[model samples]
Target: MSETVPNTTAPGRRSGGRVHRLALAGTLATVLGVSLVNGVTPAGAAEAPLSQSGKATASSSERGDLSAAAAIDGKENTRWSSAFSDPQWLQVDLGASKAIKKIVLKWENAYATAFTIQTSSGGGQWKTIHTTTAGKGGVQTLNVSATGRYVRLNTTRRSSQYGVSLWEFEVYGTGSGTATPRPSATPTTTPTTIPTKPAPTTATPPASGTNLPKGPVPPGAVRVAEFLAECPYTHRLPDDPIVMPGLSGGSHMHSFFGNTSTNADSDIKSLLKGGTTCSPKADLSSYWVPTLYSDDKPVEPTGTTFYYLGEGIKDELMAQTRPLPLGLRIVAGNAKATGVNDPTSSSRWSCLHAGEVGSSKNFVNCPAGKMLESYLDFPHCWNGKDLDSPDHKSHMSYPVNGACPASHPVIVPKLRQVLRYPVSGDPARFRLSSGPGYTMHADFFNAWPEAEMERRVRDCIRPIVKCGAGGTP
Candidate 1:
């Protein structure tokens, strides 16, 4: 996985400057009912439903049966129940900056007595727009004025011991109406028109072939390898011990696959000796990520396929790639960072045969008989020096311009991880144990026998052959 650099901008500047502008714009749109910016109608026009399209999350769920997305699913029968505690919150990402005018909450038997409606340009700092301490357990239509990409319901006091539950949490707004209004053009007696210049175009660098394996392709050769695994759900654990020490269970929740014994005490030696839950019994590696919960129950994947290939590499070049060494560990994607409205997030949600790929911000809904899918692409270039890096990410990097960089010149097989869950409906009702959908990340442990892995890479992966157990396509 590629390394991420943190943004060092001051928090005060972000909240005061950017947030203030959004608030001002939202207020104007709310009063006008239909506001136009940049010659286009905003998202809040006609009082359309906004919450259904946004991603939903919460502070903590009661169990696998009470996911936060349930509240925003537009179905009164499904409800979201938080942990039986104070200071619970339900949040939604509007996908983009929008002008919110109203919020409706349909409460279940368990409700929040004291709550506040808040908005945030990003998901971090929030500004409260409405608060009530005398909330009754029923449907509430609240008129609010705010503009943001994220809206949340912050509940402080529960009306019952059962915790806060909401059958539906609805938000209405004008979408994409939050752009700062452009100043009106000044008219002059001597009107002068300036000729507009064509925008300059910068050519993207072509894919480099420096690291490609020098060879001639065999006749009728095909290049691509895929395998299936019956990945199951395991307990959530802390980040890898080698990467983050002394922080057992400090990281977000994760659902382990393959090696069932993975935990805070796990190590390379333990993984090598541990038995696997996967088929073929010979494969002993462990793989895991934040567990996905729907309707408060853990949802496991079906028909999951793992694709191995060299990114943009020809068959001859792919044949030269080395197999993963035993005891190798790698972390892909960022779990700590929220992916809401983040287009750069590596996590992608889609459906089988849907032909459309959705990001974490706006997840795709699967039709009946179809399945929800998660896709993760791992790096293909390796440094050929260390089995692991200090940060657990530096040892591997993605191909730059379709070629490996000098520091990581060894081309290795790129892993395209696809997981399909058996649940269907609004993607909002689904979430990873780590937190929100955007916080999705994955971990992998190399536990296959050294000889077996090498043989498979040479005979199957290198030639782009699809195979499963015993390496027979």
Candidate 2:
């Protein structure tokens, strides 16, 4: 454990507790805080740097004049002075041989806007790992990855600036460890329409009470044709047979809020609630459930990649002032798809953004420059076993259909590497157990392509999937 220093101000800086003390001028809010840290110590091990394992020990160097903003204590946080401006900044040292996968920064009582979290390998070559608006009064966790011995919190909240007043900070990481390389699978030809066919015509009365918007596309909607052009996976949705069956809306087989999928007609009804005719054969749906009430739309038919769509642009725009589709992601690679038999091929798809766009480049704007790590903190599954072994069983591919197998194994040559650390609270990335079976981790299911990081979905299923063993055959 590291020792806490008493509150002491040396000319331009201040230090004491982890939080910042501030003063305001009339209605104009300006934070005045600073801290100068000194003395350096090193973590004496070769384990993952930020695991729940790395421990911090107090330094041997005595406290200095504490006036220089550049003096660092060689750990998770730096001291700042509270007499100068609205926001102050400092950096952290992760030491050598470790690549940071995540960081959780503690906050003081000040509001922050334009602040950035940066990382450097040797306290030199810095990289903007993430940008976010600091949350006041508590802890704000930011996920990021960069090779560096020094991590920094650069703030812009000062007397004349617009930013947050930062306080204490805590950093986390998975020290140096071998990152998992993506495996390769086979690719399949594109489909023609949404999979899973619809049931016999049982048209319900005209949906009422849902005041969903109709026809006049939203202010920032992308045209159907434009959407198709940008999303290559659209080419696969023409008359796909899977949509015909309408199996109980399971995970990706269809859409469901949680585990249950009822025939309340709620899903289909929601889809068509506010939609209008795009063309004679191109009817679009915009509500919760997804359905296309048309026959021959000009754009290629396809199912919505809701998660990606929501994350990339649609959700962001809906939550902001100016609406437009901004963030989009696409992926291409070799991997066996669900319901497909060939394990020696690959496929491609546009996995992100099927909604509207907005003016803001990032998800949220901040007083200091916005921190970028929050959005990049992806939930990934981690299995204890390595995928490179020959005896390993393959996981399933996401968005399953009759053309692809539920799960398929593949191979890939290691190139650029990125480790996806798993967390405890994430339901999307966890381990479960059957009544009499071994614990099953999501990492045991599937993986995304190595070349593309945007298409983050990977199926995790067994090589021989059965009705109750996690897949339906």
- TM-score per candidate: 0.51, 0.23
**Model 1 lDDT tens row, 334-359:** 66554555543566565543322222
Cα RMSD (angstroms) for every candidate in the order listed: 21.1, 22.9
Give the poorly placed runs of model 2, Cα more than 4 Å off: 1-83, 133-137, 158-167, 176-473
Each candidate's number of clashing pairs is 11, 92
Best by lDDT: 1
Worst 10 residues of 2 by lDDT: 223-232
Go through the candidates in order and give each one's C-alpha lDDT. 0.59, 0.24
